[model samples]
Target: MWENKIDINQIVEIRAKTTAFFGVGAIKKMADVAKNLSSRGIKKVIVMTGKSSHIKTGAWAVTKQALEANAIEYLLYSEVTPNPTVEQVDEAAARAKSFGAQAVIAIGGGSPIDAAKSVAILISYPEKNASELYELKFAPDTAVPLVAINLTHGTGTEVDRFAVVSIPAKEYKPAIAYDCIYPLYAIDDPALMTKLPAEQTLYVSVDAINHVVEASTTIVTNPFAILLAKETIRLVAKYLPVAVKEPENLTARYYLLYASLIAGTSFDNGLLHFTHALEHPLSAVKPELAHGLGLSMLLPAVVKEIYPASGEVLAEIFEPILPGFKGTADEADKAFAGIRNWLDGIGVTSSLKDEGFDEYMVDRLVDLAFETPSLDGLLAIAPVKATREAVRNIYTNSL
Candidate 1:
């Protein structure tokens, strides 16, 4: 797929920045990694964690022990909220700066880790707030070195260089990406995920599959993204049901973790199209809607709208995973139908109406989606240009 994009000797960067340490007992290595980063003058570390499961699972206790073992002083911020806001990041950065933090450790899921990355960036600009860092006028800055002890099997933020934050005042939730924001390393321990409830597994697995399919079908896809995406699709289809039905299955948890990481890397390279672009506002406006639920409600609609561009291609890819799927005259629609059926089979039944969206919210959602630059940006790069009518139709159809 990438052969035509480059010359024989030209170079292109393809993988994520963070090196993942996969499997059980990975957290034990956190102390060693922190000590190594400290050799470069890092002393005090800011650890981004939440007040919930990190305490119950003993992840933070281990982290505290690690830091103390390394003779490192640390500050703990447990206030990271889901769909982290710019205000939270700015607050965390201020606290980190006050502690004179030299490095950062994000323990738990994507929300805290995403906040930590932003905190890492804002640490250097004590004179500026985190909101300023996302603005075009502010020059891009490097982040303090960061590491991740990821607890969830979703939101591959652990291995990727993107941080998403909601700006309530602006009605925007945009993913902020730059070179310096990637984690220095990731500890991906499936054991940490064994206690996740079945519903949580389903929500996150839906999120993973969305990343894979959207990346593969997007207009700007590269060879690396395609390979990673194809494998991700297969992995999620095979393992997600197991994860949902048997949350404590170590093998299922391991494979699901791998799928999320692969999907994250693929999307990092290929980027997302209308699904993510449209899905963000559903949560930004509702606040209570989980991101994965929003994606479940919105992705099929976007997929149905865009299928004509690569329907048969998608049909072939999903054939093995989708039961009783066969190419038809309307193969694209069939492909989408197969996906919808698969979602139903796995117990996902989210929709705009079922999720509390009404006719009045349609215009509001569209406008909010447009507020995200990526929506219009994706239209520019999409195989089918999302006309004003098309964009409106995508939202309305989902309703």
Candidate 2:
């Protein structure tokens, strides 16, 4: 199905460095990743994370072991918030410098990993200003190697070479992108996710589902991307709930992990459309909300808006995956309906009001969405070109 996009002879240059170091659990592979670095004579290690407690996990434990074994000479820990800020990245970079770290290890969900990527850039390019990197207008002069131990499935922070950093009081967040931002190694172990609370597990899985759905639906005219998207949607529908309900279900967890990886690959190539373009501003304003939760709330509404523009395309693509909707109209309706049902089934379909966002914020959010960089990317593939008014309408509808 994806044969067209699969070019056998074409020299496709994937610039980022990525190594999937899968293990039964995070800790087992942590030692292996560190050993790989040690073999390369990497001594000083800077560990960037959101919280100190993450260190107790298998990934952190293995890192500690490496430290004791002298495989790691020094460690700098940056315990920042979920949506990391530019200031946090600068602080982490300073700490890494002070520690004389040679490599960076990020252990957490997206924020820490994203921040680590930025910090690595700052470490390698000390003379370059941070704001300049955020524009991503040019390649970095230098960037340190990063190894990520992913604790969450949705963000795909370990594989993508892009870092989102919040700019305080700004309408749009900035991204740092370079070949260097990609993790030299990515450790995805379901065992680490088993300990997450049920609510968090569900939210993260839903986020991954949304990623696949959004990416697949956006460029429906593209046959190869559509097939990949349909397969991902099927996997998410089949396994997200099981993984959410029973955290210890290794099979379910593994499926979710693979789903996230596939979703990341799709978006990495095709780019996320409206859902992400709108969701980012909301997270920036509501610092208290999880990125996954914010995405869940906005996804259904975004899907509804895009349906009119891309309904037929979506119906054809989703027909194979969701057989319950066999007829044309039935398939089209169910494609969007399935998403709402999934969100409701998992108990993540909270209104913006429930999440403490009021109608008054609609104007501000619309303004922010207009300023987002990926708007062109969203408009190019979105069922419709989302205008300022359309964005405002979606925000109002979400409320």
Candidate 3:
């Protein structure tokens, strides 16, 4: 048996750097926030977004209205996709450079916001490409300024400085953490999420739940972060189903958004484990699979896999939200089943096989999980060591 290696009473150092504007009709404050930007040398900005959701949900109109009202000349770039690729970020940088974009307004879900942050980084270093930016080829003197409008409740891209960039050519997806990518300010309006579809709402909420699970259980665990994770899980549990059942429930949307934000803060301080490490490769390889969907499919298996070493407080953290959950040796197994069942209750019942995963690709997924240097830090921080055979077994089980 693995020794009790995690320090349950570890000292905490929390770092929260983003300034946030949140409430109903919060998007209306964009003009005022942009006006604040002019004092900091921000003139023109790029409004980065996905293709249809903004238009379909009316978020695009609010974004444009804000820029125009402030006379903040902005370019609207709507090419972002789920699991945003490095090449796409490079394209956004090119647009920003051409338009002389002084700041970025990210106005969608995690993908667009993540792409916007990466674009801000690539623009600050005009001579380098996105890949080079990832390579840290040059030290940036200053980050290109940014404001994020979070239109989704998942990923918490608005609250953090990390950007997940994928390279299709090599099937690589790596998270980039730099001070420059942190939004100077963020707008998270629950009103915006009211129009979101049930699938998106539930899936993203699961993403937040997954964040709490992985962050709370990592070897870098801390008491404060676990406190945040426990509350986050409780909030997600109470609010997610209501949000799914009633998409227009502003109360549920507001609290779920808060849950995601708290989860982001927790993970930022305590970091993540191999659940996220394992999912990044799935999205990198498949591209069609959404991040949250992949997490839902993999979390049950992952919780069971890591339970042997990480189960001490997991039951306590989970019992508050998981149905019929008991804090025992089998608590991890029960918790995993409860979470998987809860996901099904919210209409997230698809497996990796249903998402086009093949058994033959297990080796590829395993290689990316254990072999990719981009994912090494997360795996290293895992409560249980991630071995080749172990990772392979997890991948196969997830299939």
Q: What is the TM-score of each candidate against the true structure?
A: 0.92, 0.87, 0.92
Instruction: Residues 1-399, candidate 1: write the lDDT tens digits.
Output: 442342322212224588877766666677777678768777799999877878876788888887787788999999887788889988889889989998889988888999999888888767877667654336556888898889888789898888887877777777677878888888887778888887778888888878877777788888787787777777788888888878877777877888898889988898877777778877788777888878877766676777777665456556556545443435556655667777888888777898899888888887876667445665566557766667678778777
Candidate 2 minimal-lDDT segment of 10 residues: 7-16
lDDT of 2 by residue, 132-211 (tens): 56645457856788888888777777888767888765655655556767889887776677677777777776677666
What overall lDDT goes with each candidate model?
Answer: 0.77, 0.71, 0.80
Candidate 2: which stretches are off by over 4 Å? 1-17, 135-141, 219-224, 316-323, 326-338, 373-381
Q: Write the per-residue lDDT of candidate 3 for residues 1-399, one digit (tens) a residue.
A: 121352312322223788877666667677778778876767799989998877876767877776677677888899999888888999889989999998888888999999998888777778788777654455554678888888899888788867787888877787777777778888877888888888888789888888888888888888878998888888887878888888887778877988888888878778887778899889988898889999989988888778777776677667655645445656666766776786777789998899998899888898877654458888888877778877776777777
- TM-score-superior candidate, 1 or 2: 1
Model 1: pairs clashing at backbone N, Cα or C within 3 Å: none
After superposition on all C-alphas, the RMSD of every candidate to the true structure, in Å, is: 5.9, 5.4, 6.6
Q: What are the runs in model 3 whose C-alpha is more than 4 Å off? A: 1-15, 135-141, 323-327
Better of 1 and 3 by lDDT: 3
Query: lDDT of candidate 3?
Result: 0.80
Candidate 3: residue 102 lDDT (0-100): 88
